[model samples]
Target: MKWLNKNRVLKVIFFALVVKPLVFIILGLNVRGKNNLPTKGPAIIAANHNSHLDTLVLMSLYPLSLLYKIRPVAAADYFLSNKYRAWFALNIIGIIPIERQRRVRKTELFSGCHTALDNDEILIIFPEGSRGQPEQISRIKKGLYHIVHDRKKTAIIPVLMHGLGKALPKGEALLVPFNCDVVIAPEMAEFQTADDFVKQLESCYQELKTYCITTTEQHN
Candidate 1:
């Protein structure tokens, strides 16, 4: 696992040469409010999960200088199931694996997240806990709530992604060329309760989705 973190050069090369071009040029990604992302980090990017493309699309919004600092939280059961996938997730994509099952200790989970934020890195967490239908945002799980509760100072950036599920839906191997849009909202720093925060986050996703649809129709 240590070697994986040391392979920063490989990660940059892969994202710059492969992921960026494939997502931006080949797939035709349309991103709005990218400047909403903070110049510095130690922040959390909470987004709705749909497809594998969501991670790549979100990471593309950041500049290369901050690329290495971006650490996505991925399901350990899936990404670390085998050596090949583990290497790809850890080294290539630079993901921080979290055990989705109940077997993982709570202390360990919080520790990993704390370490990342303490390092002033960006953490991309999908609060849905798993993938859902395209454009359909699910109820956020408690993991994000706990993270925020523990790390009070971290800024939360709400992001909504559209068209990723159609491009590469669940259980599909091949990716269809499609236009994907990512809408980033302004940062929220205060929350009264976990439930309230989650509710507001879901609302943000829906609002962004509507904005995407209206913008698309107007252009057409």
Candidate 2:
């Protein structure tokens, strides 16, 4: 529906009615460091990618007031394969699609993301690039590096998510209900060099993983 695209209210209603319930009620989520989640925009949410549910889970963490402001950075090839999928992703989910296979200018590639940042919109980015194995964190990609290279003012918050892969891994459509773990880290340090910043992100991921282990060990 064109109305879906024209009206932000409808988009907010969809997430409030559908995404929230499906993520919080059907799947169930255990989130820590929620206090670290950004209340406003111009922030980058860097997280590991697993199931498609990862986007929904992350978006649901934000308040309904910020629903329209939250845009997930997704792959153009996968999400925009056809008209129906394109409409849903672009109109409903409000994703900033990046061309993965085709060669495009740096400015053209990250144009949507840049605009989002300029508008103080929160961006949900999976630093791993694409979905990896269920419950396994992949190496942080350089794409995120390019987006934030010059904009040191914007906060980059590292997030560690668990169990979504098992619930709905890559190539599977049916969702198996699972209790998910989400740890939202504090804003990462400002970048010095590309290598240093990426390494810091990877290190942050490891620390969060270790935090999960330490917390589980304490309960045992």
lDDT of each: 0.81, 0.86
The C-alpha local distance difference test score for the whole of candidate 1 amounts to 0.81
Instruction: Report the C-alpha lDDT of model 2 over 1-220, residue by residue, as the tens digit.
Output: 7335555776788888998999988888888899999877799999999889999999998887778889999999999999999988998889999998999888789999999999999999998988976677777778888888887578999999888887888999889887888999999987778789889988988888865521222231
Model 1, C-alpha of 163: deviation from truth (Å): 0.5
Model 2 lDDT on a 0 to 1 scale: 0.86
Worst 10 residues of 2 by lDDT: 211-220
RMSD of each: 3.7, 3.7
* Superposed model 1: Cα runs more than 4 Å off: 1-6, 214-220
Which numbered prediction scores highest in lDDT against the true structure? 2
Any residue pairs clashing in model 1, and if so which?
Answer: none
